[model samples]
Target: MRILSAPLLPLLVTFIPPHVTRAQTTSVVLPFRRTFSLSVSASPIILSLPAQNEPYWLSVALCGAILPYPRFFVSNESDVTLPGPGGVQGSQTGEELNLDEGLITYRAQMSSGGALAIWPSSGAGANWTIDVAAIQDDFPTHRRLSQLPLLGDTSATRALIFSPPFFTRETQEPIFPNYTFQDAIPSVPPIPSSAEPNTTLLLFPTANANATVWLTNSACALTSKLGGVMTTTATRTVYRDSSGWRRQWFVDGLSASTNYTAYVIENNAQVSGPSYLRTKSDSFPCPLAHSIPYCPEVSYAVPLPAPPGSATSYTDDNIPQDIKA
Candidate 1:
């Protein structure tokens, strides 16, 4: 009889009876798929405003795009004060004036109409031109929206026509920061995780709404002291992958030989079915260790599904065979 070398003990361990570990756990996770129904409407335009001393308001329409607070300017017009109390540095709404560029901005409560009202100091009129432009996506941080390309038509020859003051008589409305309007509610559900310890999975939601994921030991139920939860309060970037926009999150430090149930919530409403996964027993060794500290001697067998009609149990003969002895 031949005795295996001490160096080869770990290698020989691979050929030992396969039942030394727990039964195999199946990971029947399905990928999450979601598509957005976007309706692109013809872009609307608002022309130039009349440079006048009287309070002048204009109603600019946004064709389905999220309109941010707008900024107004007086081309070649200076030494003119905006409407409101004397010595006010900016506009009536307390917005600062871009004097270098002859621009005045309004950070008031406004709606989709983008109702913009402005009044110059008495006798400040004629030849002077009023240029009104608004930002899209409600992303005020992106100053580029006030510059070229994204700034749309800024040329004097192509200035948009603003509706005459009181022509629409629009009122100040509430402001929606970073608001988005979709044709329909999206149904991006939480995907199931693999049946492995320390598993991380990707989650996707239909809208950029406040989202959360809840994990529980009980299927379809949230039991205190036996569950975990995570939430996304602020807006996050949605990655475009083969399965559309998705976000990844890790579930680590989970106990081996455990069952986990996960679900999704959008804006405080449950939006997905209970996803389930079972972890392998701690006694079972992972096919591949993430890292090895010592000289690696063991060459584990490649894991494969059991043959059709084969018993779930693995024995010395039917276990996955190693590529090398």
Candidate 2:
């Protein structure tokens, strides 16, 4: 008997599987979003300061858009001083000044409501003028509420004054630093980290509040062996991301899911945070975008089992008997 060999046919289609990444024990996280609610009107300027209020901090973002690292400061006085080394001699990549453009708004504690001016840290000469324009304001606000007498506390306002994109303009003048005001409390908060569990970040309450920030276990609860007291750097850390100041501190070690609190030992003590935060218990696996966590990345066909004693799981029995084998 003789047997004939057949030729194999080529298939027309092919399938490619999607890429899959293995899960890890650690993950990355981002800080909470900050709100810019501070708003004012320019139509009718409020020249006089509020008669019955406390001095507050003011934050300015110089050349906020153009400069690689815009100039900034948070001060309580009308004439504030910019932080970090002054002059072109020793400056970082983003510290260059472009006086003609940029913005300076009371975006922070601007609620105090007063005029603003600033000088470089290097010298006290040529204080720049910060022109803040508001859109709709009362026809005029009496310096004192008593002046409203017969009018009985009434005011008028207009809309669509300036074109759009209202901002602060800074123009330099050859004058010495002038004007002073009482100091006010700042309101910076602590930010959480995603890396090692033994770290904390402090956005100083005041620009110059370079004090120690202790990390202690919750006062209400017993201390966890995983961590103890932690402190910030001796000097202010110039964070590029902000014209404002920021710093990082190391903890002895942080225990997962443990409660802790942070506070400044000096400078500005008003912010006690009576505030506490709890550490996460597990290290989350950070994946790119696993919106559908259970979706499969690869697909395969079910392998048909051969007869109980067959050597392989492959068979052609499903083929019609009329077909060639």
Candidate 3:
């Protein structure tokens, strides 16, 4: 998300000749599919005021292209004072500036006065300028409505304009931090202790760019006994991946028949939901053992005797019977 450092003011100036010899009226037609380059010195521009207890809105209008969905974002630089009312009074610093860049499907009516005002809904003031140019040399062929009407000219020309100069203001309020965890899964299936030993576990989540991961044993008896438990292991690194796919390795030291739970910690302290896994049982016989104790030197050819007066159950001729001779 891009944060606003200062307000962008208009720069381009155009004079339109009156069609009816009346006072020349000005209309702005924002071009579609154009790269807008705006440069403002930090000293002159005013940072918006922090939003207080209420939500703030920033509105922007587009003439050629449709408006975008409403989005809210906080600025990185804050507490900036610009020349304004009351000789520059200090306001909320470093608050989020809500922007409503909604898509404008309907074109501006040429007959009606052609002036679109783009401002924040919360009325937080900002100093910024917009520069618009055609996306391509040729404009879109689709015809909808005529462009903004100039005082005397019948046709509208593509150009950039700025809102009337205004003071930057913002409401101040406590903002809560938000986080999300995602792409969490077991790295590998539970493996036997005696088997070829490289098993691992992994998890991922969407967190701030600087977020970190923490692993904890959720179902451990000690943790259950105590209301809160310290994390058994933790790893911290800058959040390089936005997909949140983090990985950790679990080498072969786990005990048999033991269940373990894992979790991801983001942004240093925020904890994610726990995932459960169990170590392979140790009770199962080790396949490497050579001696067989249950049936010593047992032969596969041996057959069992049939029940008395019952159908022959033994298929082999040499049936093992009690030696009573």
Candidate 4:
């Protein structure tokens, strides 16, 4: 089941306000609103909502007070009934929000109550506050907007933090003929190697070398007959280098705190060792208190006491936890 997941609807997500009480009433400016208290047991938990009379764009706000970095997937899918393994993918209709950062808007007009699926990218069960609203008016397109200024305070302060609006494209070229032993010699040889940051190795036979490589969280089984097919459902091809004669291959573009196994195949037969490598884990961005991977820098937020008759207030917090150094 190779699923090429693509965004179905135009979606935009805003960042959550710091330490806003879930019960705090919004100044009845938006048209429709709904709130729910949930504890996510496993990933891809689908929450159903009652449908509406007319088509309207929906805004989703999530608050994870206890989780370090909670990830969410919101879908108006007609049939997302159960939680699936791995993160949400191949959705015909849905949008994934940033981990821990809690705001998303989707252009949806629910004929009936739609479904929103939520999940954690890297944490155990934790408490979550979910808010959804149907914008009564239709906007031309989808994009993230800052929180509406409903609290009428002229002296209130606001600071905007921006991340790149586009995905970072990384292109990895094959590292060939490094100081590693060659494979495809019809014998299992000791491929002497040393660890390098964000890199791995592959060995191949120069004759039948049209090879492919895969990276996985766990070890993947290998077969002697090289499979000609490059695509597989179970694994993602991080690096694909053809022509086995390239002898020694070095693989790069790895992340820290991940265990990766590299498998090389040519024409349905395993040509190189299913070499395993584990990258060193980097330190968490937050203080030592909430140091786990899932913990966002939520504790660092200090609400500024607003002066009476002030319209705006500021909260001092560290950088976004997702923005690593």
Most lDDT-accurate candidate? 4
Kindly list the per-residue Cα lDDT of model 1 for residues 1-325, writing each as its tens digit: 9987898875554332211112121111111111111111211111222333323222121111111112232221222222223333333332333321122333323321122223322211221222233332232210111111011011111111111111121223446775555223233333333311121222222121122222221111122212233232112222222223232232234445554443432211112324444445665533321111121211222244432353322223344456212
RMSD of 2: 34.2
lDDT of 4: 0.33
Worst 10 residues of 3 by lDDT: 149-158
Residue pairs with colliding backbones in model 2 are 41-134, 42-134, 42-135, 69-94
Q: lDDT for each of the candidates?
A: 0.25, 0.22, 0.23, 0.33
- Predicted candidate 2 versus true structure: per-residue lDDT over 257-288, tens digit per residue: 45544332111111112233344444422111
Residue 244 lDDT (model 2): 27
Off by more than 4 A, model 1 = 1-240, 287-325
Best by TM-score: 4
RMSD of each: 32.1, 34.2, 29.4, 27.2
* Clashing residue pairs for model 1: 46-160, 46-161, 47-160, 47-161, 47-162, 48-160, 98-103
Cα error of candidate 1 at position 269, Å: 1.8
Consecutive 10-residue window with the lowest summed lDDT within model 2: 151-160
How many residue pairs clash per model? 7, 4, 30, 23
lDDT string for model 4 (44-109, tens) is 344554456766665555433344444455545446432233423533345555521234566665
| TM-score of each candidate structure, all chains considered together | 0.19, 0.18, 0.18, 0.28
Over 1-325, each residue of candidate 3 has an lDDT whose tens digit, in order, gives 9653444321111111111111121222333322221122121222232322322222222211112211122232322222122212222233333322211222222222212212211121332332221112132211111221111000011011111111222323445665443324212222333422121222222221123221132111112222222212222111112222122221223345554443332211112334444444554322111011122112121223322353212212322244211
lDDT of 3: 0.23
